[model samples]
Target: MSTTTAAAAIPAGRTEPDPDRVARGKPLAHLDGVPVYGWRGAPPYLRTKTQLAASRLKVTAEQEAAPLAYVRTRDYGDVPLHDPAAAVKMRPLPSSTKARMAARRTCSQCGKVRPVVLRGRPCSVCRQRAEKAEQRLRARTCAGCGTVRELPYPKHGRCHGCRQEQLEAKRARIDAWLAEVTVCAGEGCTKRRGSKKAARAWLKQHDWLLSPANPNLPDSWNSPGWPRRCTPCQKAHDAEQTRRQAENQARYEREERERRERERREAEERVRWAAAALADPGVVVLDTETTGLHEQARLVELAVVGSSGDVLLDTLLNPGEPVGDASDIHGITDDMVTGAPRFSDVLVHLTALLDRKRVLIYNKWFDIARLRHELELHYRDRAVREAVEEADPAEVAPEVLRERAAAEARLQAAAWLDAMTFEDVMIPYSDWVGEWSEYHGNNRWQPLNGGHRAAGDCHAVLACLRAMAEDVPAASGADEVSGTTVGEGGPWSRCA
Candidate 1:
């Protein structure tokens, strides 16, 4: 059915809306005897043009199938709403559009079809040829020596070397008259001028006098700025420049040698240290994966591997905090560690394991600081629990008691940390690798290939130690270190 009024004309082929579906949303008004609804108030049968477009569909033209109704939206207000059933799939590009695109792809100069739009310029190949031609116009071979080089004057080409020789000839006249060096070599007449200024003015007159002899020679040599030097003086100047260049080259080579020797010494020292650490029964590799890198970050996992390849300890430690932001990295979530023991529960066992032993940790400083923070938290919680149980209303305020507890906990935590011994494996490894960072004034730290988990990272540290302990050849030097290549098989090799 079709409806036409002065206000609007209803389009045909609009699917009839079910009354049951109509009950879903309240229809606004029958404006000009046609259904009208606001954005959220439209019936299920009604789809706006945007909704149709999103589905790769278009509303059929008024001649084909008209809109079922209208929807009033905040932006682009009162757009027609059509039944999706009456909408058609979007049509492909027309022949005129294809022709226009083809024209754009055709190069303006070469007239060849290109992968990209030429944008009024020639294709890449034609453009390159044109650029080369322009370069050739601006450059020419020197008449002397025949080396193809850029010349300031391409028409009367003379390379810098040849031009310098010509300039020296002009300067030789000045030196001849001044009695600084050799006699004049000016053609036809070899008389000397009075002062340096008189000689320069006369030189220009001489160029005009002898213009036919050197018709192609540039007039730049006749300028006042032309540096005057005799034949012997020129030889001495060239010799000084050559000597200075030789000295600079020697200095560079000396510096390079010193740098290489220094690095070799450092690498040998690192290897020795690694060997010592490996031989010592006290040294053990330790690693931990935590909630975060922050001081307050709690451990999600902890592991220790003895030098003798014994797995000393490996367990998950629940921090009782949701691993929301950091779970993606270490892949530990709240559910995974829900039943695991807290840091407080594992403190005594950890202390026992590390007693009278040297713990080697990758990035030891950060991990130790993190461990101290955990300890502080544990003591604070213990103090708070004890304080809460023995609280008296008359004694002090709750906040004041809590503050005192925290302060005491920090002191105890510090004392506990002071007793343990640790060494940074990352520092020695970085020194061996020898990539200097100017910002830090130290070697750049390498990433731990096996650091995704606590146990895996412990193995990675041990692997690094083993790699360092091996005899490094002097010739190969410490050019580069790769996590995968250095320590072939271990937890580090898992990724490779």
Candidate 2:
């Protein structure tokens, strides 16, 4: 509640107005029918509760405020105030006021409470003592001159001359310890008046003996076969060992370099051979759709298409196991291959188609490993059948006879890999483009019509090879193949 606006009119003759002065004896703001002065207008003699306590004045909340002065605000029309003189003072100090002030004073340096001053500061005595200690730390006593001197680098509170003497003494002690023991038997050893057994034991514990089998053998007291040497002999032996190790390491590094060079040459030759075969009419692009990518996964469909768009072989195979999750990738379900011929049945046909041809497969490492594994499985089953029939010595079935013959021929075919090398098309393609993309997924390389199947992938491989070949320059006069240059472009394009 605010005081009535009529209360804002003060008695005219009481005081003059000054903007800088606070609202003490002047109206500021009215709050709930009383005037209140802002904090900025407060007077020193008119104190708040905290100010009064800090002044050691006793004030009670029950005592009413005295109207010793008037305060006003816009929020509160009129307010009353109290004077500091009305409060009771606390008891006197324990000592004189000046002594108490000196006791409470702190030195800037060393943080000690002292009633001493020099140049009007409390730390004069402490500063003088610290300067004397620092001067002493800068100098050290010399062992040779027996006089205090400064060192190049302070260590153990000793000067340079003292440090040199200490080092010489340490080396002499080490020399005495060395002379007391022998490292090898064949040596002009230094004589010491110590027990021979104790010397030998000490040498052994310190690994001072050499062994032909264990190069770092330690000396032993009762080991007759072990050889011991003096310090000089040990030094010579260590030097010789280090030299031999350097020679062996150099020889090993040279041989490794030669081996890598030979491998590089051989790999380049193989790539050249594959590129030459690519131009031949017998070269075929092979692709297969398998149940999965694992070693156990079997082929569901196989495609062998010539580079010139000739379909040599395309057939669905009953892999003898369920297709499972692979059906989604190749779109070849169990129902599709239910009555299809098995890989064993088509072995003869496949080998005949691939016999003397340069088989260009995508990712040949995977396809070759898988093909060999499948053949191994077929041979294992045939061997079991042969072992069972060996007791009766009955006539072998023609199908069994054909499978055994095909498996053996294919095993021999592994050797022909030198001439009819199964080249992976990805090698040359990636070398030309410097990158790879998915052939089956929706990407730039993926076909608009079909992919992830044997036939579709075979066509994709052909397109990729043709694209790479096109980048090569054509030969002098031959233009039959797009990039078939006699000396310029061949079957493969060289990266720029």
lDDT of 2 by residue, 1-496 (tens): 3566545565667764564334444445554554456544545356654566688876654334444334554675344556567777877766787565665565766667675543335476777888877666555554345566555335444556766676676545444444533344434554333455665465557553322123232223443543455556668888989999999999999997676455444434434544454577888888888889898899889888987867888999999999989998878999999999988888788878887887888778877876776776666567656655663336666566656656765665465344455777665555443333457332122231337888777777777665554543322123434522222223443322
Colliding residue pairs in candidate 1: none
* Cα TM-score per model: 0.49, 0.38
lDDT of 1 by residue, 390-438 (tens): 8885787889888988998999989887888988988777665656678
For model 1, the superposed segments whose C-alpha errors exceed 4 Å read: 1-225, 228-243, 385-395, 430-445, 472-496
Each candidate's number of clashing pairs is 0, 30
lDDT of 1 at 346: 84
Worst 10 residues of 2 by lDDT: 210-219
Task: Give lDDT: candidate 2, residue 197.
Answer: 62
